[model samples]
Target: MSEHKPYTYVTASIHEGVTRFDVSFCTSEMSAKAFGGDGERPFLTLSSTEAHMTVTTTGGGPVTEQDVTLAREIFTASARYLANCERLHAEQPVNPTDQTTPSGEVAA
Candidate 1:
């Protein structure tokens, strides 16, 4: 069996109308517990957020939006793969019609 039982994942949480999330890429057991919130890779928060989107990384990391989607195929593929792997309990229905898919390059 793999060591990482829970597996690395992304999580979305909403509080006071703010939609927050964390993307965990770390796999080490010791490291995972230490961070308490998805290791030190980076934490993301997207506020409710009709059309405007501002990307913020916790710990004030210098990650730019450019790094968010370096490769369309790769990014979309990753999102698809994680959607199945991540232990998510989504509050919102998975909208298959969401034009926000990276493959489209634009959200309708």
Candidate 2:
């Protein structure tokens, strides 16, 4: 509930991909490597080339090990949960969005 406790989150939609991150309560901008949105994988993964963390918070360098660790844990856990949900979803049969006819056309 603190006005300046430390940070916040950003959900951005990129063409052909997605970018999600945590930003400290700063007037400037920042970026970070996040997981849980890679379409190829049911979940997400982070690595040196796969992802990165960028901070442009006007003199906000030296990101701590704890910060990166925390973000990794959070995103990984989320991805795991999503994978489980997708598994469950796949078990169900696909339902027709609307009634169909023998001609493979929508029925009135």
Go through the candidates in order and give each one's C-alpha lDDT: 0.45, 0.45
Question: Which residue ranges in model 1 land beyond 4 Å of their true spot?
Answer: 27-108
Q: For model 1, how does the per-residue alpha-carbon lDDT over 77-103 read when each residue is reduced to its tens digit?
A: 768877865533232224545534334
CA lDDT for candidate 1:
0.45
| TM-score of each candidate structure, all chains considered together | 0.22, 0.31
Clash count (model 2, backbone only) = 0
Steric clashes per prediction? 0, 0
